[model samples]
Target: MFLIRTLHKWFGLVLGVQFLLWALSGAVMALLDHHKVSGEHALLPVAGLQAPAELLPLARVAQAIGQPIQKLQLKPLHDTYVYEATTPQGVKILDAVTGAPMAIDAAKARELAVGRWSGSEPPASVSYISRHTLETRDLPLPIWRVEFADKERHALLVSATTGEVMAAKNDTWRLWDIAWMLHIMDYDDRQSFNHPLIITLGTGAAWLALSGLILLFRSFRRSDVAWVLDGAEALRRRGR
Candidate 1:
């Protein structure tokens, strides 16, 4: 126990800076909007809808997007249905009723699109455009907007009228944005997890905590013994 406590204290002292950085970074990540890191648009919810149709068919909605919906949640917005969902390619917002895009516009689309091409040259060259991709059909309109943090500089706008993808941006994610992502993705076993730094930091923190607990127990015992001994000595001195 005593050994553990000593080890814990020393571990904390050694790794204190790392923990602090992680903490600060985590806090920033939780609060900072990834889309706004570059000092651009605000991340807003997809808006312009009222409420989702209670009896609507999920299959019909999936067909509207040409893919299976991973998850779908609906909320009420001004007598319309606003839906949030995820797909294999990305996260999305949708309109529960007609599925028309309502939430976003060209400006918001630019913000999401810019992040994806942050490191790339300005004037992104389209490597290829899939002709097979269908034009916007049954998807709802954007009722609100949201900034995503999956990648640098890229954000998505979900529609509020009919659940549809409105616009996206590609650009560079700020330094703080990357830092925040790393902080959240902490794991163990770098080769397996693919993020050695976060794993290393987490492991270091665990070690520090273990050492601290051991030290605390030892200190309590030592203090109790010392107090008893001091009391005995005072009694003896008075007797003498």
Candidate 2:
């Protein structure tokens, strides 16, 4: 029993940071109710179509953009189109039809952010600014949906038509996003365990858990066999 407990404690101390990170990430994944980033109200009235407009031929647009299209989505209600395609660095977008830049208004996106911590508001940790549009003319489709990681580590969705802002959910889903990030110790894409302080704290948590598990296992030995068996049966029943 003593040996098991010691082993568990030492193991925890060694991998504490990783365990904490896992816990935090798991919690964030669980409590995230609305994973939307909010921003200034989208450019209003995206001119919903009664009938879809004859969109520019996606193939020609793709050639113009210099990349192959992966997917396309149109929102006539907002007179917008979104495309997803590949990029050298990762994925980026293009404005093939309307010639509008795929940029979003940061001030507007910020306005949509919530500041509470009830797992229902936008993230409250850091203020967000608009990201520049990553435009390319090398795609096989007229429109592209660009994938972006915001300064806040939120995934951004952009429109490729009319340069109009479509729906900004993450900037709006403010508080909830923060909780998840905090839970996982991922400040942003670059700041999770990548940060020294966060790494240390995460390690501490992992060690704590490992020690606890070891203690529990150690207690299951010798005269405690009946207790351990009962506990195992309980766990089995729960699993069933």
Candidate 3:
């Protein structure tokens, strides 16, 4: 019994901090509005606009890029109508009216991000990101990160190819992310919870629960059962 109790005490000490963090993180996530955390409120939706009266032909686009086109789309990149061409090399954008090739550079990325921003302030900073990160996880690489000069530090991610606002994030989301990291027990990537540390800790927690349940039963003494035993004897006497 003493051995079991000692083990239980040590386990509680080890897991207590993690349990408290779980509770706190859960509370924060619950209190936060889903819309704000997702940055949906910071970015505007793409509204449909009227297209140009005349568009350049597909032959002109082929001649300009000199690549075999797998697929093509005529769509609005903000106000400018452009043809998105999927070539063997990669995606190529060309002005639909003039058939001139268009590149999605840092300047163009800023335009796309700012155009989608719903806030009053223009972007505080804009940078081209070609690698994956905690902010850009699961999203396609080679994107543009646009940050706004606001209290929330509202940021927007724009696609390098299509000039679309792929994702939005803010200070609220960053705070919630810390809570999530603690809750999931994934301190590094904060993306996946199915790692070895969590699995080991989960196993320990399960053992603590099972051992605590056993201790519950073993904690009771013979005196605690005396009343029930006496009552049964009284019933037997009455029967006799």
Candidate 4:
């Protein structure tokens, strides 16, 4: 019992701050609207596309690019048609009509953002990012960050290479993300929820709870309150 109590005390001291952080972060996450945090409210509706009369043959595109095309997709960015090819080497975007390699420039990225934006106002700014950051750690590098001047101040992340809208973020989403980082105890990358430190702390917390229960039961059995109750019952029985 002494050993268990000591262990519990030390573990509690070590994990108390983490426990508070988890609780606080969990509460904040639960209170915030999930849709807004996920940027669903800022998503633009997909427009219907008319089928083209003719398309460049996959074999010809493969021969020209000198790579085997594993998959192909026809994607429309703004008013232009682009063919996205997934190959063993990497992903490549080409002009759908002319079969020429197409690179997404800042102007094209801004145009794509405007087309996908759900807000009425145009984008406030568009900037190209060549490096990864905490918020965009999961996405591929060299992305376009498109910011809007809407009520939520939403920002859209567009892939410079794939020409795809990768993610959306607002102030609410940023707060939620920070809370999630705290709740998971992942401070470095803020992406992993099941790191070794968290696993160890979780195991310690469980052990502490079980040990506390055992201590409570032992104290109840050993206390004078139990003997007093027994004595009162014996007297009642003798009177009866």
Candidate 5:
């Protein structure tokens, strides 16, 4: 009993701050608007665009790829139709109309970002980030980041490899990220929540709760509730 109380006190001291952080972070996250955190709203409407009535033959697409095609997708890249082919050399985007090979250069990345953006504000800046950032955390590397001058600080991440607008970011997402970092106890990349430090903290927290419950049950004695028991016996005799 003494040891359990001592351990509970120590664990409470160690995990007290973390517990508070978890509570505060959880509250903040719940308050945040999920729709604003993600950038699906920035996507341009594809209602008018329709699939091509006639697609180029697979042989033609394979020939333009110049490699053994492992997989292929016939999708619309904005208004233009293209075939995204996966090969040993990686994904190759070829024009479905002419079967010409296409490359997603820095210029093209910016162009695609603009095409996907639904805002009236022009692009403030475009930079190719080959490394990870808070906005591009856990996403595939080498994305083109496009920032807009809107009041929300709307930002877009376009895949440098595939020319696809992978993610959208804004001030709301930035604000929520801080809470997520604290909630997950992931200070570095803020990508994973299942690390050792968090696990240990979680275990310690659980132990604190369970120990408290055990101590509570053990702390009570029959004498403490004897009066209530006696009153109940008197009531039964009176009923008889």
Candidate 6:
């Protein structure tokens, strides 16, 4: 009984704060608007590809580039139609009209941001980042970060190589990320949910619950079992 009581006390002290954090972060995540956090509400409607009368043939482009095309797509980059392809070398963007290879510069990135942004104000700033950061660690590197002047502090991450919108982040998303990191106890990557630390803590919490239940049951009983057994035996011998 004393050992159970001691274990219960220590486990409570250890798990109390973590349990509170889990509940609080869960509540916050549930209450926030998921669409806004995911940037779905801020995405612009892109025009679909048109059936043009003439386009540069993919075979010719592949022959000129001297690389076998693995994937291909026709998409508009800033006001012009381009054939984006993935080849053995890397990603390549070519003009659909003349089959000239296209590259994304800072100015082109800004134009892409303008085309994809549905926000009211223009982008406050556009910058190129070659390395990974805390918020964009999961996304590919050498990307463009476009910031807006809206109240939510919206930012769009565009891939430098593919010209695709990688992710959208704001103040709310940042807070949610922090809460998620705390809830999962994954401080380093902030992405994993099933690491060894969390597993250990979860095991400890289950043990705490079982120990607490045993203590509660012990409280309801009178004396220990030995005293009860001795009294029952005395009554039985007296009767005999």
Q: Model 1, residue 112: displacement in angstroms?
A: 14
Return whichever of 3 and 4 wins on TM-score: 3
Q: Name the TM-score of candidate 5.
A: 0.87
57-138 per-residue lDDT for model 3 (tens digits): 7788788778888999999898789999898888988999999888888899898888888999988999888988778886
Clashing residue pairs, candidate 4? Answer: none
lDDT of 4 at 102: 80
Off by over 4 Å in 6: 49-51, 222-240
Question: Given candidate 1, what's the lDDT at residue 204?
Answer: 77
* Shift in Å, residue 9, candidate 6: 0.5
Q: Can you give the lDDT of residue 147 in candidate 3?
A: 92
| Candidate closest to the true structure, highest TM-score | 3
In candidate 3 the C-alpha lDDT for residue 117 amounts to: 88
For residues 1-240, could you state the per-residue lDDT of candidate 5 as single tens digits? 999999999999989999899999999899999888876787786535676777789888877888998999987776788899988978889888788888888778778888888999988999889988899976897888999999998988988777888889999888899999999999998879999999999898899999999999999998999999999999999999
lDDT of each: 0.51, 0.45, 0.88, 0.85, 0.87, 0.85
Sort all candidates by TM-score, best to worst.
3, 5, 6, 4, 1, 2
What is the per-residue lDDT of model 2 for residues 127-161, given as tens digits with 9 covering 90 to 100? 32234322212222223232234443333233332
Over 17-84, each residue of candidate 4 has an lDDT whose tens digit, in order, gives 88899999999999999999989878777677775678778777776567887888888766767788
Badly placed stretches (over 4 Å) of model 5 are 50-59, 221-227
Q: Considering every candidate listed, which one attains the maximal lDDT?
A: 3
Report the lDDT tens digits of candidate 6 across residue range 136-232. 8989888999998999888888889988777888888888888888989999988888899999999999999999999888786555576888899
TM-score of 4: 0.82
Ten-residue stretch with the least lDDT total in model 3: 57-66
Order by lDDT, highest first? 3, 5, 4, 6, 1, 2
Candidate 1 per-residue C-alpha lDDT over 134-224 given as tens digits, one digit per residue, 9 for 90 to 100: 1112224323333444444344434433334455443433455456444555432112334666567678788787766656565576567
Q: What TM-score, computed on C-alpha atoms, does each candidate reach?
A: 0.34, 0.33, 0.91, 0.82, 0.87, 0.86
Error of 1 at 23 (Å): 1.5
